[model samples]
Target: MSRLLALALASTLGPALSFAALSFAAPLHAQGAAAAALPKPEYLTVEQLRAKYRDPASRFMTIKGVEVHYKDEGPRGAPVLLMVHGSVSTLRTWDATTARLKTRYRIIRFDIPGYGLSGRISDEVAANVQPLDITEGLVDALGVKKLTFVGVSSGGTMGMYLAAHRPELVERLILSNTPSDPVKYDHLVMPQSFIDATARTKANNGFQDMDFWNNYLSYFAGDPKRISAKTRAEYYDFNRRVPEKYPIALVARIGDGKQATIEMAKVKAPTLLLWGNADPLLPEAAANAITRYLGSATISRVLMNDVGHYPPLEVGDRIAQLIAAYVEAGTPKL
Candidate 1:
């Protein structure tokens, strides 16, 4: 990220902003009030999102009464690969890496209910349903008996939950820049910038906040040049579509002052954690905190120098090679 930005934020919003969950109990009153005043995001419908974000191979299926936008490709007989996108992104984020792997493996990736092509959960039972529940239920609805999971950011956060709670479905895992409780352990804090971005959203009645944009680009790669114009536009569109409550609710799921129940020992599938040294969110040191819990499962840690939060995006070719090698040997590389 920007050292100047970090320094400015620390100086202006000093004494550490209190971390808040998505609940009223967590002191999220101000943000909630702001969200209440704000209208629901526009320009993203299931059909429109699919048209813009989905590939030709993409399809939509109803799972637990929710119309889930998904893509299933590659040889039917090949090994299955399930990909989960992050909070603000759609399955399209995996297009680059998925294209590379499709030649060798069956690829399946989908948009979460509140994101990308899925839009929002239109199901009658949408109330109180967790992302984990929707995701697992979707897998069952699709009859995906077994697969390896490739998750990033918030997706990795949910992936760990699924692996711990329902190990039978996941055969292996590639978790990149995953955090258990983001509110609790914010790798870096840029409070002023976040506030400024929100204010810019108010001023523009849209999501054209470059302060946050720069921060976001920084989150992806240390060198902002890697983030192309098209990538920037797509991210803006997807993120602008985000409802304020969605992120709050995501972080609030475990309740105020509580951490997600991630049983590392329960994650028996061989695990691969790809971290970027320049990751602005959870620095490499912070990312390693999750390793102690892998227990008996073979664990591989690939530390990419000079990369940022999203390894699969920053270094997809190298990441794909690592994943291919990992799948073949199916063993830890220490």
Candidate 2:
């Protein structure tokens, strides 16, 4: 059956059946505002994704009291490539590149807490948890002695944190469409206008505005056409399945981006920064500020002509090639 039809049917039956069937179906639909903004997937869950994608060596690891999902490919002892996804995005964001890199390095990707299949935080905790904690905990769980770190957007932010705080764990760093200093980004700063609008929207109980979300995605893609229908459908379905409050919580956590930027100079790993020059969310100037603070780090900037915030999806092959070359040439001598 078509994915949309299946999703509609599952939704009618309620959350239990929807979760069960969707988790097993290849490219299950992801429901949410973000999903409406991105490309649709053939499947959503790890099982469904595996059935459609075909990773010969894939497994799951429990870390930080959560079931961390990952795909391990290539030789067991080959150089490892760790991919961290952006906010509100799952590992599926790297599907295209991961498929290609499986031949060279052992590539791994996972969902952070409050995202994808990973568990959510306790309701009692008012303070937001940092994604870096999940990244570090997952690294330890995977038994990875050393590896390269590739992060996109917020994922890239986490990559910066990892390289800064745990330089010993990272061999190389690749950041795409991520602002090094969050404070400067308007979205992170959450001006009065945005805060007022968000509060009003919540008060009105208008949580799922498809048009607004789609427009946001368009800005991220640099063009709406770039986001495939399949990707959008799956993303939306995933959103619908998860709690509605999560995105609000995420927005608040990102507001602390300025604090993250302060630690940029401490990131010692060789870094490559990729930006979609046209990205509305994180402009080139924001990325420039990050490059400025990366001391003693070899930095190469690639301006994707037509892409936006989600470079991995918009230009997956090009990104994979850049990462492969950077890691191969710039990996520090042991």
Candidate 3:
């Protein structure tokens, strides 16, 4: 199959693959092979997950009838920081960063419906719903007027839409390893090798295949060694528990890149482009494109060495420091 076609297929499969679960019962060295060899894992009910993982900060509310899972942390009166995690990840991705910033800022994060502890969404429900609708509900529900908005990967795409349509609600914007236009930059955004691997996994082990996942996730880090076995297992468990239908439903609603540049041009808030220089999915070229696509008058760019796609998880302290400094510095003059 052609590269673009593979990417298109990959995009649709991306969320589903990440949401599927695995059973990692053996040691890392043994589990990688064992997971692939084992049959797909059984789905863990939301109740089970909540009982096992929910904390004091964990809260649930109805957003468009969906029981959205979210966490509100830090001082209530402090500056607000709304974080959005990318596909295949949940609010927990910000756990490390939130820990560092909670003392100073009000950090709000949620699972994007299908992932994490968020309620499952069917394809029918997702077709009529846009990510912005859910996001707006969260903001309005929390009575947040204006705040700093942060997102990674696909989550960053949601941030762009919100900043464009709800300018007053976003005091500042920060994006990391986000794609400005996925289709337009398909060559850079989804490499051929990655596409091939994705296809092979689908054909062989199916979406629940953790063998591919073990190696696939490693590619997100500059140093594969940075992602320990324990972390991979955590991701596997999270993916396995999500209802099978949610990821497919979520991907069906993802917009093509056809209108990304137009939407991005509408964002006028002060912006920070935090990119990982080593990210294979979104490389330096992708970063440059976002700068060109954004219409923000006050923009700052930071490229960290040795970091990869998931900055919050890989280098949370640094992300926290950057966010604190930038938000405290106030809006930059044009």
- Top candidate (lDDT): 3
Question: Which candidate would rank higher by TM-score, 2 or 3?
Answer: 3
lDDT of 2 by residue, 43-94 (tens): 2444443355434544566654545566666777889889877745778889
The regions of model 1 sitting more than 4 angstroms off are 1-46, 122-124, 182-198, 202-211, 242-259, 330-334
Q: 2-44 in candidate 1: lDDT tens per residue?
A: 4433433332211111123221111234345444545444555
Report lDDT per candidate: 0.63, 0.60, 0.72
The number of residue pairs in model 2 that clash at the backbone is 24
In angstroms, the error of model 1 at 323 is 0.8
Most accurate candidate by TM-score: 3
In model 1, which residue pairs have backbone atoms overlapping below 3 Å?
none
Sorted on lDDT, best first, the list reads 3, 1, 2
- Greater-TM-score candidate between 1 and 2: 1
Residue 255 of candidate 2: its Cα lDDT?
39
Deviation of model 2 at 271, angstroms: 0.3
How many residue pairs collide in each prediction? 0, 24, 1
Ranking by TM-score: 3, 1, 2
lDDT of 3 by residue, 1-334 (tens): 4454344445433563322232212123333543454555455777777787788888998877678999988898999999998857788878888999999899999988877888888666676776687889998989999888998877777787888899989888998988775433234444445454454444433444555556567767877776767667767777667456546454212355567777888998888988988986677887888888886637798898789888887888889889888888845964
